[model samples]
Target: MLGIGIVLSIFGLGFFCWLLFTLAVYALPFLAGLTAGLAALQSGAGVIGGLVVGFFAGGATLALGQMAFATTRKPVIRIIIGLLYAVPATVAGYQVSFALAGIGMSSGGWQTAFAVIGAVLSGCTAFSRMTLLVPPPDGQGTGGAYSLADERLHDQRH
Candidate 1:
């Protein structure tokens, strides 16, 4: 029974860490949504209204960020947008990593180091994922007639 408990705890921790990593990019949108939800509630909106407002606010925040990142041609502008999303994720990562490290290790220095590593990885992951909002640079994956024609023309020349 004790061994089973230990195994279950390990699995739970792994699942939690996976969830945290997957959701890190949404931290900024989540904060926005939470704030909007609380504001709506404070203004006497019912629970359902608060939830609706929060959901919309979060969705809009994410969509707008992705749109701005995807549509902009300037590298500097894209960096700025990526940073906006990554900053929150990095901070959250630091906190989460520290807590996770505390579950096993007793050394504060090691915990801090792991936390820093986690922050960097999480921020980088969020930054890279920004590209997912846009189509591939080659345009072939978009399934457009232009892409097919371009391919055939290139094939004939070669």
Candidate 2:
């Protein structure tokens, strides 16, 4: 029973971490809102006030980040924005990696190495998640289409 419990706990932790990595972009806003709401509540704000503040704070942050990314055309500016999104994820990943490696803060080099690896992995994951995939051109129909003739006919009707 003890062994089973330990196994289950480990599995749960792993699953949670997987979700975090996979959904970091979406998760970030909720985390920001929760943090802000708790802070507000602790500061003597009423429950309703806290909820409103949290909702706006989270939504604004997400919307602003997206808008900045969408509106910017310069490569350097876009890269900077991407880095902004990635840095927090990298920090979180480093913390998780450090904890999992069982390396004390005093362990210096090993800890640094693991943290770097974690940061790289998490940064890439975050960047990939944030990127929008463009749809294929209409001219390139799915293989299910019988031929270009069918595609041309369908296109003409529309």
> Against the true structure, whose TM-score is highest?
1
- Compare the candidates by lDDT and give the number of the best one: 1
In angstroms, give how far residue 119 of model 1 lies from its true place.
1.4
Residues 115-152, model 2: lDDT tens digits: 77866788778766655532334455564455777878
TM-scores of the models, in the given order?
Answer: 0.81, 0.62
Which lDDT tens digits does candidate 1 get at residues 24-68? Answer: 889989999999998999999989999999999999999999999
Cα lDDT for residue 41, model 2?
91
RMSD of each: 4.0, 5.9
Q: How many residue pairs clash per model?
A: 0, 0
**Which residue pairs in model 2 clash with each other?**
none
